[model samples]
Target: MNAGYVRLSRDDDKRNYTSIENQKLIITQFAAENNLIIDRWYEDDGISGYKFDRPGFHQLMADLDKDIDQVLVKDFSRLGRHNARVLLLLDEFQERGKRLIVIDDHYDSMQTEDDTIGIKTWYNEKYVKDTSQKIKRAIGARQKAGTLMIRPPFGYTRSHKDKSEIEIVPEEANYIKTIYSLYLQGSGYRMIAGYLTGNQIPTPSMARHAQDFAKGVISKHKIAIQWSDSMVRDILGNDFYTGTLRLQKRARSTVHGKDKRVPKSKQYVFENHHPAIVDKASFDLVQELKKKRIKSNYRSSHAQPAQPELSSPFGSCLFCKDCGSRLTPIRRPASGRERKYYICTTYNTKGRLHCSKAHLIEEETLMNDLIAYMKLCRNSLCKDITAYNLECTGDEKKTSVRKQTELQSRIDVLKKQMQILFTQKIRDLANAHGCEKVINESYDAMQKEILTQICESEKQLKTLRNSILTDTDKKERSQSALQITDRIIEMKTLDRRDIEILVKKITVDKDGLPEIELRYGLSHLIPCSPSCHLNRQENEIIYQCMNLILQSDRDYTSARYLSRALTDIHYPKSAKGVLPYIGLMLKAGILSQGSSPQKPYIINKNRFEIKKVMDTFIKNCCLV
Candidate 1:
């Protein structure tokens, strides 16, 4: 059987002479003229010749030893541009007793000596390398002139007048503004994404496709209508929304190599190059908030927490004053009741050798203390806004600046060391030290370690730079904190989002007292306050109802069962009367309803709010 192989890459498509159709025509005509019939056809379209692992090529190779007695191509370049691989493939053909034919080069294996095949393969490889370099130079020239062709970002489209420039798409720009607005209003990436998805807003990809469909450029296809946290994060982090053109941030080292991220110092950033969707100040503020959140949530240990979704409001805010480590939440079962508490992470993981005290504080008690502190601050601010100074201290700024300088200097030193090691490795390879394999392996390991350190140091430096707040930023943050404090006081509950906006850290001392640090430099030691006391009669009623539900053996206790149980206990009430208490318990997160509407309720043992309400009632009141 005779096999005809056809291939055409992007470079080949530039000229009609090397098109797939043209190659097929030439091969078919040559076979007909030679009175030979081609039985199998293998074609790889728009694939690089430098890559030998293409599907069409693999199929052709698989049949070489079985059905294929002859392989034909228009030229050797069509088979491959990889010099070594192509030479080895030619040898493979000879060893397998297969006849080879290249019409363009006028080569037939059965009739030719093929002494110049090696040189021809090398020239083919050189052509590809030269073409790659030429294309890169052209792109470089365009980039320097701000005329490089690029796909526009989500909220933009290429200008009709000048394809090199971008203009805002009004509908898409509105979504971009909404994302930034929600982020500044203390919405997390996931929360913002959920909001957009719930609102049925089209994602960037969907919107782009819709435009193309409307223009009749492509047929309509099904696309997912969803938004992801990563999409939200990308939009929020893009300085392009602020009318900046950031380009050349990624490039390939070799023609066939994967693209690598270019360092910030090497990227081209042109400010005010297009219409703005978000202001520079707001963008900077969002970046600062993102950095703070990342720093707070980062844990030294790689292990994930057991219940991340059920994490306390103070998860990121709580810390230990003694060891200066973030506190971790733990749940303990006590007499059939589960209670949540926060302890110093250092003491919990390590022993007394690292930290002397647990600094244990109940979740309920911490919430009460934090609420009281917020109330006190709100009262103080209401009386006189200037009562407490919120200006950042000079010493803190100086220390941060010093640290930034040190990190930058360290990064510079690491880069120099990396260059030196690379030079040393080259010299060793050239000199053929002790064993070639051992020398290469040792240098490769060292190179990997140094590269890892350099990446880590660069990341730390970027985070530090983002964390540094300017004077304008401090003033704005202080005013925003005041507003957030008022809102939290009015709600009388602190959620995770509220904590992220208002508090920087809550440091608990060895005595288990928390010091509240506000975001804009306000710090206070929360004064001890009386525990919340509920009405005795109401507490008794709640206790009786909760006890009945807990004592029930069934997984789900219906409201009717609770009414009957209460009557048997001499506290008679109809199911309708029991509904009120059930509603309150559900609202407090102490009880959860089943998935189906007909199913009853189940106790929520893991909720921290349950412990607060239950313990307070159990201490002050007895069963009714």
Candidate 2:
């Protein structure tokens, strides 16, 4: 059996010799001429010649297990551009006692003895490397010049008049705008992709080409590709929709020459080259969301402790109106001991209350007030949203005048260009191509330019339509968000899990009133007063103990042991029995697990104070 191989390095070159039909024709002719029966055909279309990893290449290797007689190619270049790969394949053929032939080169593996051919092969290898480098250089130059280089970005098509200008692709451009608008509205990347698929919009890669082949518009059809989250994310992150081009966001190695994407900081960006679908404000909003997503991803990867679920709807709704600190819930013992309440986070890290006043609020009364306020906010938002939507519809008349002026200007330019091209054709005064040729070129340019203008007008119309929908949608969504917040708040009690969905931050005031801030702008004020407060002298003494804990000769295990002991002092009488068990663990060395825990524990002589300060210095940046 004779097998044939083919490859085209410059991608575009494949259009000539590497076509499926051409490969089949060459393989069949070579097989018949050599009287070699073929068993099967292998093909790898659009595969690079520089890489050995290819679909058809694997099939060919697998076929070697069969009783193959020889391998044939139109030329040696079909095998590979790499010299080492060619040499390895040649040695493999020799070991198998199989012959290789390149009909175009008139070379046969069976002959095997030519010093001149060896030099030619070396030269061919150099040629391949040189050609690859030249192509890379050309692409780099185009990128630096701010031209649309390889692929026209999503929502745009390369301009026929000047390949550098990327004209808006109407259908795709509207979809791109929708993606950005939705993203700013808190819809995520995957949601935007789902929306596109749900709307049955043709993905950018598969859209119909506006080119006309009969009039010699490039005779190529675009292949349809499916919508994916990756595609949506790329569009959302791209600055192209904002009329800016960001270049050189990648680098090729100086040694191995493998290209690696350069970091975002290295990218060269120029703004306002084309019309912007997303303004700077919306783009910045999207960026903030992106940052939040990045932070969330990082947190998830580290597996941070799960947030506690809120027990009452109103429980998590309360915050310190003064310092914005969350009021931590403190439950009393089962023995009917008095309930205690306090805040979460250090109120004063530097032994000063100049920045914040620590406030502690009782939990029971806070929830009732929060629930009442939420009901009020919900009704208010509903009323305001309805009023805003009505006002927005009243402004529709303003756009008609602007649209008429734009359309008139575009029509006038198109008519003038058509007349000039026709006049040039009749004059026959050009030095180079005669009037006919000049006229034909000018006519083609005019048609394409006119088409581009029409596409722009259509895009503007779409924008006008979208703008009408936007104000109403914004009001509706805002009302919906407030309603969701109200629902979260209306719950009499909440657990930590419920709180995570609605509450972002909680703060306690000096008066111990907890003011809850909802995720969607619903605010509620409540009375969350603390049961007790240690005097300034007492807190200072505790601070002194903390300093001692840090200066102690004890290790972490021993110090943490002492810290837990001090924290347990606030426990009620019924839970007091558990303290002995803790003490037993300390004595048995189980608390520190046979290691000293003394480093984190502190004891002070003044005010009979005891406290624990863990050694949590994060790389010399000590944080409380």
Candidate 3:
């Protein structure tokens, strides 16, 4: 039977023309025209098409019981717009003996007339990326022009004359102010969210009341409702609450037209955009307080409850005490129950496999170490700050003057280059002749390099601003010292949430002794890997994944499964980010996957050689 799939990216509000009903209609017409029977229609409404984790899409793929002959979509983009994901899905379909037909794009399942699917796909991918860049530029341009790109937030309303200008919404503004005040006084996020919901205060989205808002031609009325935890968190996280207009907190995907939250480094933060809802001092304090809160409950040592980590937790941490090879996690089936243990990654390999086997650390130990480390880090900031201030930073003025001048100089140069590049890009477009591909590539490469340089310079400037002029001793002595107080309170309890915020890295020495690194509210001290501190059980699992990849089939699904399982063990690190390394592993025959036109995957192997290599790398015996 033929199936249809429809996906509306997160940023692309589907309540408009891209609604399920409308998509069904479009696909139904196309299917009828082609005399194809519609077996099932899969819809991932309001989900980003950048990743293949959408609920409906996964279900469609996993529906092995049902006989699916072909899959149809409005465009290949509906399956996924990301180049990696799109190609994999297409390949997967072919593997499964199921064909895919994208109607709107004229990509037929049976047709190989042009035989340029790969090139066309690349073009489509580039188009998506180019479109995203254009959108960002547009937003940046408006922001530079002093025009507001977002709504006036919950408490404020847009001025009648100027859409960019913000005016307080009188009653709502007062309520919002009260909320801020209450939060500063120690009201938690959930409590505040509950309070607003209980009082029936309209959420920011609800207050918009756009009865005929245009998402596209076909529109629908979506009733906005009360505030939720997520909404409250978003509001609280906004630097604009402190009278700063920080634009570009989120970015649109080039391929999917979906929104993903950008790292703080990429944001275009302009101070004093609008009237402050809360003072800068108070806003900063709130941010600090939020950091002290930690979530402790975890099913595995590698799991992080709420936030993404900057570095891998498990990288360069696990090692075998006996052989000095990294201990890899091993799974054993005993009495119908699965138990995890650690073995030398090279234990069962050729050439004197070393180390007497050791028993696995229980899951409980994993939880204990993670929670304890988290608590220690969250609680140490104030003390560390105190210690750091006393020991270092005798020459503040010298650093400040030097940094400020350098930043200003760099900014001036970048602005001049940016202007030239803008003009050059226009010229390139207008004069598209003589190896257009080569010309475009050259221009794009230059643009990318320029943007990267500008971004780095901007980051250095931000760092300088945060430090330099501020007197650590005087600041600490004068106002209710935010650092010392937070540290004392958080460390005492060692709460799970507190630990999550404070602990940066946990490294395990050769003797199974774990070392925890604290962030100390400073960027410089952050460790690259924390999971190194995890016991042997965790490392074993990572080793297993490496072995599975080396021995099994090479495919996205296989790698994803390995990633998921390893995550459950203690490699809470993401495999997706290390795609190049993974690809390398596949090429080296250290990792392998089963061949399937659709859903290629890595299989579990009962060997320790793969784990040994990974262990050596983690222990720094082998460089990454």
Candidate 4:
């Protein structure tokens, strides 16, 4: 059956010109002109054409089960403006043997060429870009005219007669004065925020929400009210209190979407553009004092110095074992000298009652300990390497032989399953139509699914049979790890780069005792056959992921924490990317869980399970 989809959004037009009624009328006319029967008319009112995620769209998608033969729309942009999303929807329709017609764009999915569809889709995307550029140019023109294009600063509000002009808010101005007074009186940003929070004074964000609520710009429910240290710092840094408005403090690129601070040379500073809450002299004085305090804080040592060692090689690798928060670098006055040490960030900010431990470990002490740890790791690897060196140049090739035999065994089982399906098909249709009758649709479908499985198993077996490693390949690959071990054994001191090569992360407890995690290269140590289910990188990631889950003391952990832990050890990884690794582990019975994958994983017999997995690597004499 043919269906029509129509949508209109306020962003398209404030007036009812692009209303739902108008779009439906257009679709109706198009269907009538083409002599097509409209089974249903789906309407999405007040929804953006830029996004496909609408209630009406989802309902129409669900109705595909009713055998929708064709979909008609007023235009391609009405279907959706985003090129990639709209194209994907078109592809889905094509795959299901459904036709799509866009009247205004003169595009028909069944009749139009791929490149023609692509060009029309490109035009739809370009419309959004053109609109964005126009708005940006308008803003630029206003900026050149010294017009205030941003929201009112902390102690000010938009003028009653002129919305672009700033006016002093008497009540908020008093708080602004108090903040400057406190800073001049030697109060830090943290203390200032605390004082305001303790007194029940609304923060800048809360105050802005209050103004927005008064003007009916936003609903009362959205007035999220809170005070924080960063807010106080932002208020203190703003020079708007001195009757000067700053513009272009930060710039965001259209291509790369991250905001970066515009250099001082490029930033525009307009003086005396707003009502004064603080004098220019006071603002300048506060800025100078801030500079001095920052310079003092960054110094190496104070008074009598302890024996200086190399600077902290570990940048953000160390963490507090108890809270899992990073160990922030701090210099504390100790026995008439400044000592550089790391403390748990949570305890440093929230106090001991929250974390119950400072986790204070000096950098020099941690550095020396790390050096010793690397040496110990190198020695252990060297012993393993020596044994592997004595082995007969990979003569038996036990791992590849075992893997090939296992894959062949799986293929045998799949072949048997196929044969059984053949027998079942014969019995199922023995006398359905006639003696020469073909298998029914149900049996045919079953056969297809089984055939796919059998093909995959046979392919895996073929790959295993072809991928054979010789004795020389093993010795050559093992050389790099052996060289690294030998180098670490001869080294007297270690730096940050050296530490990165040896360790992944370092965890320290409340008592300053440390636990180091070595980055053992599993892919190189236990090489996979060319036809293996996983590649070298995937195998390494799987091994590391399993170790992280099993080694943790907690029985369960959120997907978020697992992803973050991996990211902190490696690159900036998100929870979604780690799912495949988790799937692989689950497939091999190396990891187990009782809850949903979205929920926390409950590692069952984690120690025993992980040990069994590691035993496989050891049995293969995996060392490279």
Best by lDDT: 1
Error of 1 at 624 (Å): 49
TM-score of each: 0.55, 0.44, 0.38, 0.42
Candidate 4 accuracy as TM-score: 0.42
Off by over 4 Å in 1: 13-16, 160-165, 177-188, 219-222, 280-315, 320-504, 510-513, 516-624
Best by TM-score: 1
lDDT tens digits, residue span 11-62, model 2? 4343344666776687788778868765666666766565678888787877
Task: Please report how far candidate 2 places residue 601 from its true position, in Å.
Answer: 45
Q: Model 3, 320: alpha-carbon shift in Å?
A: 44
* Best-to-worst ranking by TM-score: 1, 2, 4, 3
Residue lDDT tens for model 1, 1-624: 999999988865355357778788899999999999989899999888998979999988898878999989999889999999988987788788899899987777777576888899898899889999988876775454344376787899987786655788999999998888666554677777877887889998898897787777784556668999899999999898986677788999987889999998888655445667786767876787788668766432123222224445665668899888888878778659777788998899997789999998777657766776777766655533333323334455676688678768877987898899999988888989568899889998777766665665565556556644456545655564457577777776787656765677778887566777766644433332222221333355577777665565655667888788877876555575577678877886667888875667877754354456777767756432
**Residue pairs with clashing backbones, model 1:** none
lDDT of 3 by residue, 1-624 (tens): 788888876444233437667777888998898888898878888776666778998888887337777888877667775777677767677667777888777786566465666765676567556656776676675554335656577767777796645666667666666566545543555667766777778777666664124323334336658667777777777777765666667765544446889897876665545556665555665576566433211112222222122111332233444555544555557558765434445454533435444322332344456554444344444565556655444454565677678767877897789789879877877787776788778778767666655665665566456633226435644433345445545554443333334444443343344545555545344343344434343445445556555555443445566666656765553444234345556664554565674655443333476566666756853223
lDDT of 4 by residue, 1-624 (tens): 889988876556344256678787788887888787788988888776676779999998888768777888887777877888888988888787778888887778787564677787778778766766766666564453346766777888888996755688999999988887666544566767667777788887788888887888874444436567687777778888876656777766662246799897776555445557876646776786577447434222223221123234564567889998777777667669777788888899999888999887777557656655555555556656665545634644665577567657766876788799888877767656664434567677666665655654454445446544346544555575567566655675565445544555678876566766655542234233211312333345555676787778887655677688877776334465566567666677655665676655666556886878766754553423
In model 3, state the lDDT of residue 359. Answer: 20
TM-score pick, better of 1 and 4: 1
lDDT of 3 at 492: 41
The lDDT of model 2 is: 0.55
Better of 2 and 3 by TM-score: 2
